[model samples]
Target: MSHPTAPPPYEDHNPLYPGPPRPGGYGQPSVLPGGYPAYPTYPQPGYGHPAGYPQPVPPVHPMPMNYGHDYSEEERAGSDSFGEWDNRKVRHTFIQKVYCIISVQLLITVAIIAIFTFVEPVSEYVRNNVAVYYVSYAVFLATYLILACCQGPRRRFPWNIILLTVFTLALGFMTGTISSMYETKAVIIAMIITAVVAIAVTIFCFQTKVDFTSCTGLFCVLGIVLMVTGIVTSIVLLFRYIYWLHMVYAALGAICFTLFLAYDTQVVLGNRKHTISPEDYITGALQIYTDIVYIFTFVLQLVGNRD
Candidate 1:
């Protein structure tokens, strides 16, 4: 069979047939071979049906959806930068406030100890009233424990600040009484050492990438070990005379609590992924205070000149 030749293009100026009514409109492009439209139909009638054949749409570049609001360039840039700046400022303020609370608590605790250590009448009274000291210590510790473990909206607002202040004061009283039993020189030295170590650990937690928060399980185990060791050491000191044993116990306790200080600092900093919230400043201060107390206690034991 002979091959059929292609038909000539439909001309709009043809005198014979007037070119099929100008392919659906005047000034519109002619439909090309195989029913493809030749020109863009943007801003024209029959937009989707140009020249009776579907016009190849210029690929409508839809505006990126902005959660339904049409934000201008400056508005979008300002919003993004403002959001980042606000987050950074919030974190900075939170850290500063938390540290300020911690510093105040530390000062209160240290002042209590200094009062008891330096004041002759207060030291004598605490030394003489053994029963009262024990009672007050037990009461303060129980109060702190209950308040610390309790979690609710009460732990949120003004209640948290009030409770934490009370806890700090009570703990300071207990610590002052206990420190009074130690030699003044030992107490002062221990305080200095504890302060230095705390400062160093706080700096390390802030600067280092080591995520001490991940060792929660390890800390719990160490806490249990310390408790058992404390019980055994207390019993030994109570029933038997062992100076070296006391020293060893004190040294071990100091080591454990220093680690705890580092861990708690990391949690308080809230920089790591497993960090405590900035809102938990009360808890953070409590943790750091407890670590410092234990550190001081152990250091005092190691340095105290026992009669």
Candidate 2:
């Protein structure tokens, strides 16, 4: 034992090699200020020790240390800026379209309505009372059908919105004027109430936190039913005495259309995808405007009919 010397320790130097397994998770129980671990130490991958020998400090590279993944503040800021720009562009384009669609449609519609409504008083006396009204109605119905069904390659929605609005105003004015002979203040008041309700529903969709995406399908089904009911009722009016029934159908139409308005607005705001096309912002606005106008008119009928 007096002349015996131990053999030199073995050394292996490959970075990727998984060294001897640790008894516990590594990098835990952080070293104390003096470099001693608070608890028993776990060995790093290259920290080999023979029996009864103390651990040695391993080699560190000249390159920067990589603790798996590290994020720099500069890199994080650049990524955030790019993301914000893209989102802002999308939102800005969307809002521009919204105003363009709504404004064009409303202007055209109001112009047409003023031309006719202001020219004709509701109390004007006319011969062949029923025939003239039917002809006037046919003109409006034809216009509405073209606006609803005509979807072509050209950006016709703006033109259509203009046309539809013009016709809508005409219809409203004529209806309002003629109904004035029978129009108690009640009907106009009813219309104002309906407008308030419709606007309230729209505001609630945007403002209130309750999610309304699920109601889209329900609104579409009810909208179709309301349109069909209006058509069927109009047809049946020729065969029977049901003017009061028309008012009832009108009320239902108002309710259904209000729901459609809520659903459609949500789509424009990206909350729903109820309609297939979104690029034609005007078309969507017109659909909403048409529904609201119809609801207002129908609501007016209740006021007009009330004794």
TM-scores of all candidate predictions against the true structure: 0.71, 0.55
Model 1 Cα shift for residue 138 (angstroms): 2.2
Collision pairs in model 2: 109-165, 109-166, 113-169, 113-170, 122-177, 187-303
Provide the lowest-lDDT 10-residue window in model 2: 6-15
Across 59-141, the per-residue lDDT of candidate 2 in tens digits comes to: 34345676665668876675443433335566457656765656565455445444433434423432225455566677677
Alpha-carbon lDDT of model 2: 0.57
| Candidate 1: segments with Cα more than 4 A from true spot | 1-86
Question: In candidate 2, how many Å is residue 90 off?
Answer: 4.9
Off by over 4 Å in 2: 1-122, 125-136, 153-178, 209-213, 242-244, 274-278
List lDDT for all candidates, in order: 0.75, 0.57
Q: Lowest summed-lDDT stretch of 10 residues in model 1? A: 16-25
**Residue-level lDDT for 1 in candidate 1:** 54
Return the top candidate by lDDT: 1
